[model samples]
Target: MAHWNFSLLFGSAVLWAMLIPCRAFPTGAPASACENMLPVHTGVQPQPTRAPYEFLLSSPSFLNGQPINIQILGPAYKGLLLEARSFGSNAALGIWKTPPNNTKFLQCSGNPHGAVTHSNTNLKTRQTTYTWLPPNSGCPPVVMFIATVAQSREIYWTNVKSKVIWKNPKATCGAQMLTRTWPAAALLSSMLLILLVYL
Candidate 1:
């Protein structure tokens, strides 16, 4: 009877150990390294200058956050910084063009001549547009746009879920992959521990 009770207790401990890794190492990909690093505003959320623009992609859908060419149609100026932030949390995602100065979370990874590449006007309609290519990895499910004026440090942010594009196929794969291996590893460890305890 004592031996049986010991085995049950040991097995329970091993099972608990197995669960720790699943929680510690999250299978889901984080939106960014600097996710939710920015200061939160307690006051009312600010309104955007105009309706959020559309994000046009070459492909109908993205795979595992793969790098894709994109174009934007909206109000953009020469000095304003076009940044992508995770929806709701507003964590810095990526910039269309590197800013003259880096934000708390965003690095200057944008093209120096980004304004020229991003901003163009239609000669016929006088509408301004921009183009950007987000990084190939670490993309969240959804993101919103922010137009930041460098000189005045003013920010114009789109409404939450304003522009939804790009989902990571790896988000599903990572979890499944971890589940496949984790059980095997945990079983092996548990068996070894049980054997040692019996001996």
Candidate 2:
């Protein structure tokens, strides 16, 4: 009987120990094990970024009498309003944010307070360009055009700056494309005619 009681106690103790580990290993041990293990990822989404229109005119410049051609050299930025500001000239050009006209002049509004504009025909380019012909004869007191990109409701915001220069016709015109030369005979004949008339 004494031996049987001792064996029974030992067996019961082993059974309890085994059962405790079964419960602890699955629930208690696994809870901590999982906690230490790599965490579960919810999901991966793309983070929002800056707007494309932030840099519309990579190089901006103006010609006192001619025109101002803006090159949209950066990634395509459509649906953005472009406003050209000529500060020293004290002029404001407000252009709608639209797909680059490729080569189309900025339309001038008829409103008295309307912003100045470049002829639609003049704004032509193979690349994306916002063209504006500054008024000639009397250049703006201080002309500086600003192309502002409008912000969308999305995560992006608008950006603007004025680093453009004044590109004079002299700089853009080719040397070979100069005015035609008058014939020597025609010049002499005209001179003789003028001299005869004076006499």
Best by lDDT: 1
TM-score of candidate 1 on Cα atoms, chains taken together:
0.37
Q: After superposition, how far is residue 66 of candidate 2 from its true place, in Å?
A: 2.1
Tens digits of per-residue lDDT, candidate 1, 1-199, equal 9999999999999998876544311111122322322112223233445544455555543444343444444444222334555556544454343312221122333323222211211121114334344445555665444443211113334232224554554433122222444578899999999999999
Q: What is the TM-score of each predicted model, taking all chains together?
A: 0.37, 0.35
Residue 180 lDDT (model 1): 46
- Pairs that collide, model 1: 98-110
For candidate 2, what is the lDDT?
Answer: 0.38
Write the residue-wise lDDT of candidate 2 on 28-67 in tens digits. Answer: 1111211112111123221245434333343344443444
* Clash tally, candidates in order: 1, 25
TM-score of 2: 0.35
Instruction: Show the lowest summed lDDT stretch of 10 residues, model 1.
Output: 117-126
